[model samples]
Target: MTRAARPGAAATRPGFVWALPAAVFFLMFALTPLLLVVVLSFTSWDGIGEPRFNGLDNWTALLHDPVMIQSVWTTLLLTALGVVTQTPVSILLGVWAAGHQRNRAVLSAVYFVPLLLSATAVSVVWRAVLDPNFGVPAQLTWLFGDGNLLGSKGGAIGVLTFVGVWQFTPLHALIYQGGARAIPQVLYQAAAVDGAGRVRQFLHVTLPQLRNTIITSVILMVVGGLTTFDTVLILTQGGPGTDTTVTAYYMYQKAFKGFDFGVGSAIALVLVVVATLISLAVVRLSGYDRMRGTAEGL
Candidate 1:
């Protein structure tokens, strides 16, 4: 009997034609709206009439607006805090969860439950829990003061950051878990032979091996942090006098609440530019765009 023939690479490889539909969809939905928003930024619109040409007006207003400036700083502050808090936690949890132990597998399933909930649901649940009159804070007045987490600037910001860490860490943890598993076991054995203990092995071998994964996770965190809206809306409504107002929420307030679509579009464009530039810079600096590092061998 003749041996079965293997499929050729030419046959297995997908061509660009197969991706045309997705490309078209992205162009229609993503690029088209973005282009419209860019144009809208240079025009005055209130969602009632046609956009009127008003070059530099929106930009000038946004640049001089104190609230806009505060929102940018607030955005950066939240994003930075998220990165600092979530990255280490995700890495540690991911490494631990990557183990083949059955107990760990069970715990990992439980740990990732938060990621399954919608942001809206999570916010609603937490909002109730933090309610000053009816929630846990009410019962524990001695500890939580008035339990009005959404009332003050510091309290609202704290709740937002905490919710972010709780809800998003699982996702980054899963990313790191996959990266940890992809690391070659031989490297660990070699470290062991060289008298490296668990801590040293993890630091010298595991961390270096997970550089690309770390970068990927960090980029995702930065983007998510920048675009945070639903949580803020449901939790604080940008209240406490704009203390918790992020750029994304500010854009919504301008476009929808205040009926200033021009400034809102400008804010939206700025957000897109900021996120793109930061992500691109990170990719360039980390050499990740070239697909370098631990992925080479496997």
Candidate 2:
């Protein structure tokens, strides 16, 4: 009797026609621009004229520009803050909500309200709410003295961080909530039999079970921080100074305001490289590609 073909081979068989539309879309929109940017980064183009080959001039300028350096630092700081503050808080919120069945729906809705609004809307609303003359700042004058958060370097940074955390935390919490729900109830019972208190059970069973979810959250946080633009643009517009001007903002200024497409492309390319490297490092450190069980091993 003839052996039937394996499912794996059948599944892996080329389906070029089925994939054609997606392949075409990727090539036209994604791959084309990426290739264009790499080519443009080596040319001196002012967005209007023909691009003239400029070698390493743009790269050298990017390396030495003080404002560029500051923006890069700010971007890194923002990403770091998101990773530090958002991911764990999201998990904690998820755990709290999961344990409290009655309030879960209400709590989830409240947390997710910010996400329902467009980024532009959130920025506008927050701008008004944080206005020094008439908003929360006015009420908190005793704490902040001048209460002009968007008008100061450190305050602007803090405001951006707050906005980032507020907007994304709910989404991350949802991710964690799903992961938490998937965990076998038996694990908690086993831990309880071993005298594991709530905290101990969380540290041992819940967290370990959510290892993949946590790593995924971290990646989203980092990437979100890197690409954060509309909030800063609408709220602060890169600041009273350059303090809130992230690498993305700086790249925009170079490309649009400065009309230097070459340098702007270089900055974009640099950010792409940095983000990719950082993501890979996070995955490697978390051992995300290794064995699937046990957070300790990861």
Candidate 3:
């Protein structure tokens, strides 16, 4: 009996040993880089040179930087617009798609095409569309009158917002569609028997069931909006006079263009902190933790 028990314990030891490899991999690949960035955020370093400890100077400079302030404001604005625009559109599209099972695959594919495209590709496409002279806007201006959409601050930001929505709507739509499809047909049948109209059914049944999915999608879009860099960089280049520069772009400029790694790292740290806080706030407001079980059903 003792010898048989010893063999079983030896077999179990391999599983414990396998867990060690995963822990070691995570420490080496993930934790180490994060810790290095945190350390670098408090020190000054030119790319080619060794980092030197600078204490709070980097943080202090960040507080005083006008560009940094502007970047933060722009990031907030984009995030707000994304949440407001993307959530409902995705929900509506998702509801519609879920109802049309025969067409779901084709519609999902069409909607997801933009998402499959690279950031560089999106930028190039939009750049051509927004070109001041020979682009789609120019043709539209010829038909309308003096409507230089990308030439003005509001218009530029609006275009950026629209592009962001277009790119991300498919992702949100898929999320919502999955949620909507998971809802039992019995609920819809009961709602119909009670003479509930489309709007009321959506409001009372669909929306409540989708609360968790909406929260998750909104959080993802908010973080993406706040950290948007590639699209803005390619489309407006923070142009029309720094009107479109989000915090990510500012971080890039500071670190790469201005050779200020410490300040750049500080900005990156701020972005991480802000995104985390906002996500937590959304989860709390939406009662996502409480609804975790229901959401799993969807």
Per-residue lDDT over 34-129 for candidate 3, one digit per residue giving the tens place of the 0 to 100 score:
788789899999888899999999999999988889989989998899889989898998888887666777877787898798888987898787
Candidate 3 residue-wise lDDT at 44: 98
The full ranking of all candidates by TM-score, starting with the best, is: 2, 1, 3
| CA RMSD per model (angstroms) | 4.1, 3.3, 4.7
Give the clashing residue pairs of candidate 3, or none: none
Instruction: Tell me the whole-model lDDT of each prediction, alpha carbons only.
Output: 0.94, 0.88, 0.85
- Point out where model 1 deviates above 4 Å: 1-17, 139-143, 295-298
Name every residue pair that clashes in candidate 1.
none
Model 3: lowest-lDDT 10 consecutive positions: 289-298
lDDT of 3 at 218: 87
The candidate 1 region of ten consecutive residues with least summed lDDT is: 1-10
Ranked by lDDT, top first = 1, 2, 3
- Summarize candidate 2's per-residue lDDT along 1-298 as a digit string, tens digits: 4889887987888888989999999999999999999999999999787999999999999889999999989999989988898988899988776754667778787877876888889889889999888999798888877887888888998988898888888889888888888788888998999999999999999998998989988988888888888888898889878889999988898899999999999999999998998899889999987747643432
lDDT of 2 at 246: 92
